[model samples]
Target: MEGSLCDLPAGLRGDYAAAGPDFTLPQDWAAYTPADHATWRTLYARQAALLPPHAATAYREGLARLDFTAGVPDFAEATARLRAATGWSLVAVPGLLPDDAFFAHLAARRFPVTRWIRRPEELDYIVEPDIFHDAFGHVPLLTQPDFARFLEAYGQLGDAAARIGALKPLARLYWHMVEFGLIREGGAIRAYGAGILSSSAETLHATTGAAARRLRFDLRRVLRSDYFIDHLQPTYFVIDDFSKLFGAMRDLPAQLAAARDAAPIPPGAAAPGDQPIP
Candidate 1:
């Protein structure tokens, strides 16, 4: 939804209480109204139709493991599936978490989720993550073994990067890869990133559009590239294989240490010869 349950459509308001450490998650996860279920169903159906052709196999399988089609999933039930898959569980949270809290949760293998649904009118657009964005958009990909490991490593890297004051560059790498990365499989490009999978409109553009540049995955170059979070991504990095992402983490501690000692680059500036398509 555009905001929170307090801002929901008329039929969606129900007796829900807080469910997170922040005390902003709804307590009544089981009592979601019929409208809430309908909303979940509607969003699920649309994404399902769009995802199969573009999204990765792991995401498709994760959706099944979570029984995502059942409706707006109960956090407890969803956590059970995720825990079984990746030693990670979903915890309820209010909204955008502080960077430290977010990184800590990732480091601990716990994903903090915003436990509210978006309003019907705000289906395709919202300023923050609602249940659909959190659960539907992100939870499914966690089922993959490599992607799951990468998340934990990314969290650890984030903490270290924060200390070095390189969080912006690190976040940019994450933005391009984990959030919107595409991959090559059997000669065709496919979506593996959550941001593209849950987005019904952008999936097509991400895969076939000529407007955006598709670059080979290169760590330093990615950290130097600029992005616009409020709009469709101007460029995307394609991975020849997802395994390379996790492999980088095996030595990530050393790499982050090195990045910390390296000089910072200005935002929107690309590294030498790293020009992305206009």
Candidate 2:
């Protein structure tokens, strides 16, 4: 989900041609090889083992309610559970999609997940988001009411951001908060962002490594910040609660404009007034 559509590999490009107008496709559950399911299980077990001490409570609770450990989950089955929990459903897609199409799906409460799993060689790293990243990393949080609402609200704002040429800043909001954010819980920092939660290295690095800077979340600073997609994030914004995340949407348009007018803050640099979360 983090990569651009242009970044899709040439071989995988066929999935785009086979996709429907909305870029939606069937999960083709039966096509997954036994090896594919094994990869999912390995990734699941490894990440799950590391999550208890580092993951956000909401994410852990949501993950507990789903059955993703045996193998790659069937989208239809996962959809049923998600819809029952928070009015959200899963739809299969090729990989990264056009911005408009991606947002439209989210606005309708349908999450578009990649249908293919990563190869054995790509177990530790994949250039683009694979099924593991889209489903295992992102889906669990969709079960939380506030985080779910926040995502829908984000999708609703996509058109406006596009209209005003403010999509860059808007994307920064998604990158920093939705993909690589951190949170303070019970006096310790925890990971809530999909990007951090999904990777074994990042899960540890983001929570305990001294290399990255963790600052208290500030809507304006986040909108003006730049991030790295090819490597672990150098900086992360920490939110006090999901409610505050959803509340920031109230003034997003104005903030987007202001962010567009300001120079971007470098990935690991802190602004003068940035509140460091220690």
Candidate 3:
């Protein structure tokens, strides 16, 4: 069926949970079918080849520590490596959790991951995050200290953003940086976000001879900018260093309010095209 897990017969939430842990998988580590292994291999091989010249050094090194081999990763194994590196860990959750729950998890230094993998036919894109996207795309970056701190700060700020009806803009910030951001390393740009690392198409577009403009990380401008949920990103924020991002949020609540106070720009407005700064 096209929807597969998502299309489970009605009243199936209980069934799904009973089938296994509702929030996190056991990493069955050895239960993967040949097909599953092939899927992982296919995705991994493609990204590995494409990311070296394009991906940030931290992301590249994190990928190695993940030690993706021939099958679905053991969350236990992955979490062990990640915890040692940055004290961050992954928690499994049913797909598309409520924003509050999502933020709560992140606030506590835990990432909510969808427990299922995408079917072979649906490899290029999936509506919700899959195991590949969560485990492969996102987890690796959690290994970096600065990125890890920024994520925690993001979560804490999410609470305040929610209270002020600013969660969307805050999420836009996350989408731009943690999920699809590029970074300047030694005077060269490279990919660091999970959304870019896990997808072959975005991986190429982000690094190759493409038409996208990579801008320097500007928190106020980023929160004011709009992003598309259903397509490739029209723009990307480039970070000089992940540490800068972490430090930028020291007063995230105030900054978010400031951005909100500024006249809202239409979604996707270019930085230069924004209303003149007062």
Q: Clash pairs of candidate 2? A: none
Let me know the TM-score candidate 1 reaches against the reference structure.
0.84
Put down candidate 2 lDDT per residue, 214-237, tens digits, no spaces.
999999999999988888888989
TM-score for candidate 2, residues paired by index = 0.95
TM-scores, all models, native as reference:
0.84, 0.95, 0.87
Estimate, for each residue in 1-278, the C-alpha lDDT of model 3 and write its tens digit: 01134433344232245333233444455666888878888888877888778889898889888898667787777778888998888776556555666677788888877666778997888777777888888888888999999999888776688778787678778888888988888877788888988888887777653576677777788887777777777778787888999988876787787777676555445657433211
Candidate that scores best on lDDT: 2
TM-score preference between candidates 1 and 3, better one: 3
lDDT of 3 at 167: 70
lDDT (C-alpha, whole model) for all candidates = 0.73, 0.88, 0.75
lDDT of 1 by residue, 124-177 (tens): 877677778888878888888888888888887776787677777777767788
Full candidate order by TM-score, most accurate first: 2, 3, 1
| Model 2 regions more than 4 Å off | 1-14
lDDT of 3 at 187: 77
Per-candidate clashes come to 4, 0, 1
Worst 10 residues of 1 by lDDT: 1-10
The count of backbone overlaps in candidate 1 is 4
- Candidate 2 local Cα displacement, residue 233, angstroms: 0.9
